[model samples]
Target: MSLEIVDSCVGCFACEPLCPNKAISAVMQPGEPLFFINPDKCTECLGDHDLPQCAEICPIEGAIVDEYGEALNPLGSLTGIPLHLLEQMREAECRQ
Candidate 1:
């Protein structure tokens, strides 16, 4: 299966060069520019690496996803913070 690059990508250019298939590229869309992955060219790095290089290298959580629409780098993955803890912190801030 292939991976998809969602709008959450901040155009950091971190995943482009790392892709073995050269599937990811910058898309100049109006309002906000973002990177995209060519589904036809994407192979989830099955033959190249243990994990998808793009997702492994992407700094933004939830930016890269599988064909099933599941995030490869979900929230709290890079931050190492639990989702519940983050939510609690937000609630505490709101109460202050």
Candidate 2:
């Protein structure tokens, strides 16, 4: 499974350091700034812990999700972010 931070994120930077794989990154946007988790670096904390550290620390609910765009199940979770969203974000960033 993977994770993606939605636009609802307030850029609180709360989920940044919590990522064990150091996947989360702070990006400055035009309107509202937010954090982006690098799918390549993201491991969903699977090998490190039973839960995704970023999700665990995220104060905002529904901010993270799996490849199916469903909320990540905190129960014995895996690592990485959804390939689709990750690619989208990467492409968006590149265009910026």
Which has the greatest lDDT?
1
lDDT string for model 1 (2-86, tens) is 8998877888888899999999888878976688889899999998999889988888888888989999988899999999998
Candidate 1 collision pairs: none
Off by over 4 Å in 1: 29-32, 88-96
Best by TM-score, which number?
Answer: 1
lDDT of 2 by residue, 1-96 (tens): 468888767888877877788888988889777888887888889889998887777765467887788765432243356767667876999999
Q: How accurate is candidate 2 locally (lDDT)?
A: 0.75
Instruction: Give the range of the ten consecutive residues with the poorest summed lDDT in model 1.
Output: 24-33
Q: What are the models' TM-scores?
A: 0.82, 0.67
